[model samples]
Target: MVAKLRPYRRPAIILAITAIGAAAIFLGRPAIAEAAAVDGETEFVLNTFAFLIWGALVMWMCAGFTMLESGSVRTKNASMICLKNIGIYSIAGLAYFVIGYNLMYVDVVGDFIGSFNLL
Candidate 1:
């Protein structure tokens, strides 16, 4: 019987994982809802905590990507790839500080596009 079901094992494992994930979401709904009902100060603290946690996760992801790229590329070019990644991240941060915030938060009057003026 086990041999007969061997071919189906992959799908069975996937289905099991999906079922466990579904069960977790179903079970955790109440806690999620409760967290949504916080007061102003509690909400501020929660939002700040969430942002810090999210930022840490993003930093970890950057490191993971750097490692993965360095491992996949040729040895001679690995350092260049790491440098490019660092440069890209730095430029992205600079762009966000210079233009991204103004584009997002500043109000616009046109139907499709925002005002060209920077805040």
Candidate 2:
């Protein structure tokens, strides 16, 4: 016979969550957070770390898409699916580097769009 969990659920869940939250709060502080002053160096480090994390997440997301697309296709076509996924990601990044970079870094030449010069 299965023991009913309902009676213990409230205390058990609260204890588990409290333990996890305490651990996270106490253990998740990095060296940067310990800095005494919020200086340019700290700002720079935080920005760089944030960018690296964002890039890693984007790469992981792309990999997931590739896997999902490949798995959805027939075995014979999976290779094509993988290739297309990678190609699309590559082209999209390149396009962003060209257009989006220009949009952000260069002055907007047109009111609606960004710099058209191919970089």
- Model 2 error, position 70 (Å): 1.5
Every model's Cα RMSD, please?
5.6, 5.5
Q: What is the TM-score of each candidate against the true structure?
A: 0.59, 0.59
Summarize candidate 1's per-residue lDDT along 1-119 as a digit string, tens digits.
Answer: 99999999999999999999999989967776666566888977887789779978998899899999999989999999999999998998888767876665467777354554764
State each model's CA lDDT, in order.
0.83, 0.82
Alpha-carbon lDDT of model 1: 0.83
Inter-residue clash pairs, candidate 2: none
